[model samples]
Target: MKKITDEQLNQYLEIRIKLGEENFKFINACYDEVLLLKKEEATKNIKFEITDFSKFRDFAKK
Candidate 1:
């Protein structure tokens, strides 16, 4: 199995977010399916990080 890089994943995410509503839903569903495959195949380790956009906005006001 080929390793997936952070850049590749981010590019995919950006593309998905820019898609139309119906396409976005489809992309999300496919993402879930691919994640399962990645887990099973153990291609590479993946991690998720979340940030609060509101916090960034507050900081910008400073």
Candidate 2:
């Protein structure tokens, strides 16, 4: 199978919508899998360390 860039996902979805259900079902599954992979990479790279929880607590107290 050929790989498509994440940038082309939305464009492909738009085209898929105007197209047929059988084609849309298969392509939409691919699109969902790609979205999951992208989201995983995005969240994986984020540092979730709470370096200043006190500031958040202080603000919450106001």
Candidate 3:
């Protein structure tokens, strides 16, 4: 995901301000999409540990 330019940010803010509250739904939708993308990107390099469940079998039985 590329970063948005300052010009683009200004344009979006201007349009959002002029459009008022009615445009909130659209803004929120865009925000959700961006947030999802960022979260996906952040997790791309994560290393997950696999837990061994055999050790817990006796506890579960008890």
Highest-TM-score candidate: 2
Model 3, runs deviating above 4 Å? 1-17, 47-62
Better of 1 and 2 by TM-score: 2
Candidate 2 residue spans exceeding 4 A from truth: 1-14, 17-19, 45-62
lDDT of 2 by residue, 1-62 (tens): 79898879988777877887898888879999999999999889666558678877899999
Instruction: Put down candidate 3 lDDT per residue, 1-62, tens digits, no spaces.
Output: 79999999999888888889778778889999999999999999976555646646767888
TM-score of each: 0.38, 0.43, 0.42
lDDT (C-alpha, whole model) for all candidates: 0.81, 0.84, 0.84
Q: Report lDDT (Cα) of residue 19, candidate 2.
A: 83
lDDT of 1 by residue, 1-62 (tens): 89999999999788877886789888779989999987878845644346666777899999
The global Cα lDDT (0 to 1) of model 3 is 0.84
Cα RMSD (Å) between model 1 and the true structure?
A: 11.9
Question: What would the TM-score be for candidate 3 when compared with the true structure?
Answer: 0.42
lDDT of model 3, residue 51: 62
